[model samples]
Every structure is written in C-alpha cells, then in structure tokens.
Target: MDIALINPFLAAAKHVLKTMAGVDVRPGKPFLKKDDLAKGDVSAIIGITGVASGSMALVFTEKCILGIVSSLLGESYPKINDDVRDAVGELTNMICGDGRRRLAADGFSLQAGVPTIVSGKDHSIRHFADGPRLAVPFETDHGAFMVEVAFGKPH
Candidate 1:
C-alpha cells in the first residue's frame, strides 16, 4: 500500500473529531493489524471502491463513542441506543467523505458505500480486501479510538 494514503484518514479524523464532537484526538503511531478481532466496543464500517478497493473502519470504545454523540447533540447518552448508532453512522460518513475528498485531490477517486455499525463485546471485523491492514490509534481526553483500513492502492 502507498503510505501516502493513510495521511488523509489521519488528518480527516482529527478534523472531524475536533469539529463535530468538540473532542481533541491525538494520533498514535500507525501499525499493521495483526488479528481479526477489534479492540473497540463499537465500530462503523464503510466500503471504499474505485481507485481504492477496500474499506475503512472507525472503531471506538463505548465511552468514546457515547461521549462523541453526547457532544454532538448537546445531550447525554449513557447507552448505545438507536440515537447513538445513528450518530456513529453519521460520523463514519463524515470521516469517509472528508478522506475521500482528499484522496480525490491526490488522484485516488473512490466511491464509498453506506456505513454499517456493529457493536458488542469483541465483535470482530474482517476487512474487505486481501491486503495489509493499517491501524491508526487515537487518544482523546475521554477515551481512545482507532481507524483500521485495508485498501489496495492503484498500480
């Protein structure tokens, strides 16, 4: 995979979190995923095709996502209900859209599909493609989260 592709996601994620959720996210070092099991409690996944044939997953702990929804809506949600799920979907879409826009600017035109959210203890994710998956972890004041991506860069 081209290393350049990951920068868009990192930049977009930081921007989205600070703008939408009023949370500041600090990115950790990027690494390759070593297992299928996810580290977070909830995840929003969006498929990416065209120049990038794969998917992007935004994974968050229960506390982190709930905090995000609460900050976004100006309310408190103690559990992961429908409202919280909807907000996760919206967050996934926003991050994906922002990253895709940057990819377009760099000539990687990708079409993103609808985001699907799944939450449960240890509910794992299998990436869409047969390529190396990159995991970028982020830390916030409230909690930590990460984005995992498996995309085959255009030759």
Candidate 2:
C-alpha cells in the first residue's frame, strides 16, 4: 500500500477526533493486517469508489468510543446503544469524507457510501478491495482505536 494513500486518513482522523469529539489522538505505526477479526468491540465501515475503489473502517474499543461520544455530545453513555451506534456511523462518514476531500485536492476523485456500524466481540471486517489491508492504530487519553484501509480494485 502506498503511504500517500494512508496519509490523508491519518490527518483526517486526527482532525475529526479533535474538532468534533474534543479528543486528542496519537497515531501509532502502520502495519499489514493478517486476519478479518476486528481489533475492537465495535466498528464502522464505508466503501469508496471513483479514483479509489476500496473501503475504510474505524474500529473502536468500548472505552474509546464511550469517551469520544461523551465528549462529542456532552452526555455519558454507560454502554453501546442505538445512539452510540449512530454516532459511530457519523464519525466513520466524517472521517471518510474528510479524507476523500484531501485526496481530491491531490487529483484523486473519490466518493464514499453510507457507513455501516457493527458491534460485538470477535466480529469480522471484510474490505471490498482485493489487496493488503493497512491498519493504523491510534491512542487517546480515553482508550485506543484503529483505522483500517484497503485501496485497490474491487473484488
């Protein structure tokens, strides 16, 4: 995977988390994933088309999301509920849209589908592209989450 492709997402994730949720995020090293098992308890995924045909997913641990949503909406969520799921979906969409906007400035036209949220332990995330899955781990004061990207031809 090209580092260029991943850079936009890294920046966008940082921007979105900070501006929207009032959370500070630190990105860890990027790596190739070897399995479909989700790294966290919940995830939001969105498909991309146009210049890049692939998918992006944001996986969040329970603690991570709770902290984010609580800061974002100024409300405490004891656990993942319908409202939490909606927030995850919106967060995923915003990240994808912001990243796509950056990519567009680089002359890569892209479009994203509506985000899909999934929850549960040991859930799997299947990307639509046929290529190596690049995952970047992020740390926050509340907890940790991951950003997974797969950009290439559709499978």
Candidate 3:
C-alpha cells in the first residue's frame, strides 16, 4: 500500500475520533488481509467516487457501534436505534470527506458517495479491483475499530 494513501486515512481517523467523540485514538500496526474485511455480521460501508475510485468502510461490533454512537451524542446508547445508525453513517461520511480532501490536496480530486450501513454476521466485504487495500486499526477509550480503504485507477 502507498504510504501516501494510508497516512491520510490514519490522520482522518484520529481527527474524527477526537473531534466528534472526544476520544484520543492511537493507530495500531497496519496489515493487509485478503479475507473478508467486514467486521462481525454488520458493517457500515461507504464509498467515494470521482477523480479516484474506491470505498471506505467502518466496521465494528454491535457493542462498539453503540458505544461510538453514545460517545458522539454525549448520551448513553444502551441499544441501537435509528439515531444510532444515522450517527454511525454520518460519522463514516465525515471520515470519507476528510480523506477526499486530503487526497485532493495531494493532487487526487475525488467525490464521496452516500454511506450504506450493512448489518449481518460473518459477512465480508470484497474489493475486487487491482489496487491496494489498506486495513487500519484504531484504539480508543471506548474500544478499537477499523477503517478499510481500497482504490485503483479505472481500466
């Protein structure tokens, strides 16, 4: 994976967590996984298209998703609701927006598409393009989560 692309993702994740959730996050050692990249059974996946073609996914366990929603709302989210799902979708959107901006600054202009939330167990997301897919793990006070990015030039 290009450090250029991966660095922005790490930065965006850190920035989003701190600004939106009031949580400090540290990135873990990043590695590539060809296996299904989805987390647990449910994942909130969002894609960005334009000057660049790729997708970004926010994968979390049920508990982790609720914790994130609670932190963002400054209230306890004991159970997942429409508000919680919307919050997760919007949060992923922001991360993708930040990433698009960073990429543009680096001479890669892009536009983000709508984020889709997928819920299921043992389901994996597949990116079948001939480009690098980076999986970055982040640790926060609430828990750990992952951000996955995959991109390549159009054939």
Candidate 4:
C-alpha cells in the first residue's frame, strides 16, 4: 500500500482528536494488518469510493471512546451506549472528510459512505478489499486505538 494514500487518514485522526477533543495523540509506527483481530471494543468503519475504493476503520477501546465523547459532549459517558456509538460514527465521518479533502490534492477524489459501527470484545473486521491494510496505532491519555486504511487506485 502507498504511504501517500495512508498518511491523510493518520493525519486527520490525529488532527481531529487534538483539535476537537483537546487530546494529543501519539501515533505508533504503522504496520500491515494481516488477518489479525482488531484490538478494540468499538469500531466505526467507513467506505471510500469514487476515485479510490476500499475502507477505513477507526477502532477504539471503550475507555478511549468514553474520553473522546466526554470531551465532545461536555459530560462523561460512564459507559457505551447508543449515543456513544453515534458519536463514534460522527467522529469517523469528520476524519474521513478531512482525509478526503487532503487526498483530493493528491489526485484522489474520494467519497465516504455512511459509517458502519460494531462493538464487542475483539470484533475482527476484515477489509472488504483484497489489498493490504496500513494500520496506524495511536496512544492517548485516555487509551489506545488504531486507524486502519486499505484502499485501491482511482477508478
């Protein structure tokens, strides 16, 4: 996979959390995801289509979700609920939007689909595409999570 294609998602995620949640996130060196289970309690997956086709997932631990939602809503959500899920979806949307705008400058005009959310212990989400995924793991004061991106050339 191209780091050129993957960097926007990483940048957007870090920028979003820092600007919106007031949280400074440190991203670990990216690695390829090879059928490994996701290390998250909740994940929001968004499809990218148009110039490029594939998906991106924002996976988060329960504590990470709670911390971000608390900053966004000004109230701590003691647990995961429907509201928490919705917040995750919206956060993913924001990151996708930022990434899309950035990718357009790199010649890929991407469109993001409605986010699909899943929550469970070790819910493994396989990429719908046959390409390798570039997984960027992040560490914040709240917890750790990952941003996984797997995309293809423009159609």
Candidate 5:
C-alpha cells in the first residue's frame, strides 16, 4: 500500500475532529488489515472516486457518535436520530473531501463519491480485493474511533 494515500486521511481526521467536533484527536499507528469491520453501535462511511478510487469509513460506538455529534452541533442529542446520522455523514464527507483535495495537490486527482451511514451493533463492512486496505485508529476527547481506507486503481 502506498503511504502517500494515507497521509491525507490522517490530516483530514485531525482537522475534522478539532474544527467541527471541538475535540482534539490523536492518531495512533497505521495498520494494514485484510478485513476492517467492527461490531459497533454507529458507523459512517464515505467513498471517493475519480482520479483515485477507494472508500473511507468511520466507525465508533453509539455513545461516542452521539457525543461527537452533539459537540459538533452544539447541542446534546439524547439518542441517535436522523439529525445525528446526517451530521455524522457530513463529517465523514468533509474528511473525504479534504483528503481528496490534499491528494490531488500531490498529483493524485480524485472525485467525490457518495457517503453512506450505517448504525447498529455487530455490523461489518467488507471491501473488494482490488487493492490495499488501511485501518487507522484515532482517539478523541469523546472516545475512540477508526478510519478504514480501501484503494483501487488510480483514475
């Protein structure tokens, strides 16, 4: 896997958590995983394509998601609802967008892909065997979350 492709995601995650969620996030070691899936309460994923092809997923527990969403929205959400889902989706999208721009500047052109939100316990996301997958774990003030990246052929 290309380390160049993973830097943007790390930068974007730090930026998004600090700017939007009002929380400082510290990234941990990056690891390569064959399957990156979690049995968690809340998981949001954003896929990007164009010059580059891949998907990025953010997964965390429901409590952690709610806390982050509440901080970003400046209100307390008692439970997970449509608003929470939308906020999470948008956050994931922003990270992807920022990552795309950074990667583009580095000579990799990427197009925006649709963002998807998934919630519940014990759910899993699997990627195709077309390319390498990287899993980056992060710790935020609210809780722990993970970012999963899958890269395909460059576009």
Candidate 6:
C-alpha cells in the first residue's frame, strides 16, 4: 500500500470539516477494510488518477451529516435531502483537492474526477482499485463518519 497517499487525506478530512463546518473531528485508527459495505448512511466517492490511481470515499451517518451541513450552511437539515447530498459532494471535492495539493508539495501529481453520492443502508462502495481499502473512521459531537481509500499502482 502507498501509505504516503493516505496521510494527506486524513489531514484534509479533519481540516475541511473544522475549517468549513466548524466541526471538530477526532480520527480513529486506520484499518484495512475487507468488505465493500459503506460505514455510514451517505457517501461521496471520487476517482483519483496521476502518479497513482484509485478511489476515495467520504462516508457519513445521517446524523453526522445533518450536523455538519447544519453548521456549514447555518440551516437545519431535517433529513438527507438533495441539499445534503450536494453538500457531501462539495465536501468530498474540497477534501480531495486539499489532499492533492498537499501531495503535490511532496512531488505527487494527482487529479480527481467529479464525486458521486450514494445513500442508504448497506450500500457498497466499489473502489477503482480491487484490494483492501484503508479505512479511517472519524467522530464528532453529532455522530461518526469514515474515509476510505484504495490505492492502485503508480502510473
């Protein structure tokens, strides 16, 4: 695994939530994900290509996302509506962009595709890479979420 590509995302997730939504995030220990099942009620997935190719997913429980969007937009979200889904996509894009920027400083060249949203119970996140994904779970006052990254070979 190219762990060098993972740290930046962890940092980016924490930074994005705190800076944009004012939500302080606590990241849990990262572990290898052996299944495709998403950890939350909603997920934003983006494909990455360049020095390495793979996919990144930001998964959020309904309550966690509700709290985040509420804080981010200064409006209450009673449910996971279109607005909430849009927020998930935007957040995924920003987090990946920030992570790519950081990696660039270390000589990595990466580009991200548009994010796609998936929501429901027991939905699977089929990553671009066919292997165990690095899953990093996060917690906030409202609820918990997770970030998963699967890396492929360097191009």
**Pairing residues by index, what is the TM-score of model 5?**
0.90
Clash pairs of candidate 2? none
For candidate 3, the per-residue lDDT at 79 reads: 67
Report the C-alpha lDDT of model 2 over 79-137, residue by residue, as the tens digit. Answer: 99999999999999999999999999998888899998999999999998988899999
The better-scoring model by TM-score among 1 and 6 is 6
Per-prediction backbone clash count: 0, 0, 2, 0, 1, 0
Clashing residue pairs in candidate 4 (N, C-alpha, C atoms within 3 angstroms) = none
lDDT of 1 by residue, 1-155 (tens): 78777789888999998998889999999899989888998898888888668889999899998888889999999988989888888998999899989989999888989999998989898778878899999998878899998877422
Q: What is the descending lDDT order?
A: 6, 2, 1, 4, 5, 3
Cα deviation at 144, candidate 3, in Å, is 1.4
User: Runs in model 3 with CA error above 4 Å?
Assistant: 128-130, 153-155
TM-score leader? 2
Model 4 lDDT tens row, 16-84: 888888988999988888884878999988888886688999999999889988998889899989999
Q: TM-scores of the models, in the given order?
A: 0.95, 0.98, 0.87, 0.94, 0.90, 0.97
Across 40-118, the per-residue lDDT of candidate 6 in tens digits comes to 9999999999988999999999999999999999999999999999999999999999999999999999999999999
Candidate 1 deviant stretches above 4 angstroms:
153-155
Worst 10 residues of 2 by lDDT: 1-10
Candidates 5 and 6 compared: the better one by TM-score is 6
Go through the candidates in order and give the C-alpha RMSD of each one to the true structure.
Answer: 2.1, 0.7, 2.1, 2.0, 2.2, 1.6
lDDT (10s digit) by residue, model 5, range 1-155: 67798789889988988887788888889788775566366777766776557778888777778888888888998888899888878988899888888898999987766777887767777653357878888877777888888888643
Full-model lDDT, candidate 5: 0.79
- Expressed as tens digits, the lDDT of each residue in 1-155 for candidate 3 is 45676677678877987899877887888877677647553466676677667777877777777777787887887766778778878888888888777888999777777888766677777653447778887777666778888777532
